[model samples]
Target: MANPDECDTMIVGLGAMGSAALHHLASRGVKVLGVDRFVTPHIHGSTHGRTRIIREAYYEHPCYVPIVQRAYELWAALEKEIGERLFVQTGGLMIGPPEGELFAGALRSATEHGLAHTILEPAEVQARFPGFRVPRGSLALHEPRAGLLLPERCVEAHLALARRAGATIRTGITVTGWTADDGVRIATDAGELRARTLILAAGPWLPALVPDLDLPLNVERQLFHWFEPASHPEWYDAAHSPISLIEYADARFFATFPDVGHGVKAGIHHEGAVIDIDAPRAPASAAEGVEMQALLARYLPQAAGRIVDRATCVYTNTPDHDFLLDRHPAHPNVIIASPCSGHGFKFASAIGEILADLATTGETSFDLGPFAISRFQAPAT
Candidate 1:
């Protein structure tokens, strides 16, 4: 391994966030080097899920509204720049008990952000989305700006554009370790990399990179299953079906993608098992499908099936379930980003922009208060 002596920035992950950061920085003519263990669009990280929810009226919190709106613009811009279909606008629905988090949270965000939404009773919901059958006493909040993001395609486009922007992107090269010397020296599988600043967006491997931070980032095992629709396939199609999140007496998680070739893909966000990145991620098990089936059987039985396919991915999460996007306490040149708590892919583009602003200008326009590391200090581990 030889050292080139210097670079402007070195990104430790080439997944969604890292790739977007690389593109933004590289586009600015910054000499950036991005390293990833595997070529992106691979299933190893959190970005490979076939379909991710993109909703404007954020049920998670209202603070995310500004960043997510920026993300939509970027996503559309990316689709045009790459000349590929990256997103499908099928609108979005949050279905649950009228008082459950799904409906109430959506309503809260809707009111705060002044988002356009519809309060629909179960009968109205079923009439509009025959594929979904909410509980007898449930309600649904429909947001038209919400839809679906093609994860693999988005990653591919971002990296392709990043490399085109003159960033030195190195895949198949894993970072062994990094530390603050004069600047930052990163040891990788292929060579030693030196950069004036370092960005650790290593998702699941973030804690391992900075054990001193004591980040309570749990790598949860999330499973995605593509099932054969029992009936009304067209009704569940992207044009006709809205990406929906259901919170019934049983459990809660969003579902979507209108039969994008494979089928309607779905998963429960927070119902994943705690896992270590080094250990083998559990393969999609029958027991896992059972839980999903239980939800479907109660809510939308027509969507359940002999799962044609399933895959495992990881989400690096904080205790508060927000992101830990902050500069290193001791080494300010180093930054950390794990903006996913089972639900963050929608803001990948905005996150990219924020990382670039922090890397180049030391600040961002968005209110990152909800995502700061201090929010996790007390129970981060």
Candidate 2:
């Protein structure tokens, strides 16, 4: 029998990915143990934002289409199992120039995957969603399946279900260090624990956890703001509007969410300044709020109201801006699963299942080739 402090699999970081992993592993009857530095569903990490966008026609890559599709199924299953409303399908619009990466990529993925989507002109955009006004010559891809996910609730439900499935969960316990020899040895601030395999899903803290590998992970500071619609609040409601990703300028993007009672949320996609993971996150400054308000004035003038609420989060980015989900090169028993590049929250459900599959069976059906760590390494000279 395994010791009380030991388990078949140990997962560090109970944030979005880690929490889902714990739930999936435990559900499969795996003796899994999960640890986190602070209480999960907290605002300290990237998962705390009240809402995150979920879309099927992935503009990032077509490879993400299948993974996200699987995530949709798992998310519904999770909601049913836990009796919680985790996802809201408000549809989604990918707005940008016809040849821009945002619209072109989304169209490519939708066509490649045979996903149902409609292309709309600026007039149609205004006719269908009055709150938004796209620039002339620009276009929008309307995907019926895209929506938003309540992240904190999703993490809470996953952890709750994991505990119910006999998984051991320890909050406020920090993993100081870890090793992988015959098996896996985890050294925590509390004490030491052992597991047959280990999963590193620490998000921004993942790089420090495996210093020997010198993982090239950049922790960027991102901000999110909520505003009361300046006019026609009903036009920005979920019923009237859909989650939108607008590329207002060449290669620049921002996302907007319909008001879900807390005001309409908006955030720039990837213009954040890179920062130290341990640095105290500065609150949204007046200048930052003004910048966001100005941006909204152009595409979503109705959502350019006073900033009722604002918060900051971090994104661990890889150089290629894709996820890094694979086993450690030197330690096969250890899996590194983070660096989601700001857009990973929606896929946490499917990623959790992939992590659980890797931890238990050493493989998964999903093709993770593009996300492998080796993609960053150079060929041996």
Top candidate (TM-score)? 2
TM-score of each: 0.95, 0.98
Candidate 2, superposed: residue stretches over 4 Å from native: none
Q: Identify the runs in model 1 with alpha carbons over 4 angstroms from their true place.
A: 1-5, 378-381
lDDT of 1 at 161: 91
Q: Model 2 over residues 1-381: C-alpha lDDT tens digits? A: 246477999999999999999999999999999999999888877887789999999999999998999999999999999998999889999999999999999999999999999999999999999999899989999999999899999999999999999999989899989888879989999999999999999999998899987778898899999999998999998888899999989999999999988999999998999998787878889999999989987988988998999999999999989999999998988999984799999899999999999998899999999999898887789
| Candidate 2 local lDDT, residue 122 | 94
Candidate 1 contains a number of clashing pairs equal to 1
What is each predicted model's overall lDDT from 0 to 1? 0.83, 0.92
Task: Let me know the TM-score candidate 2 reaches against the reference structure.
Answer: 0.98
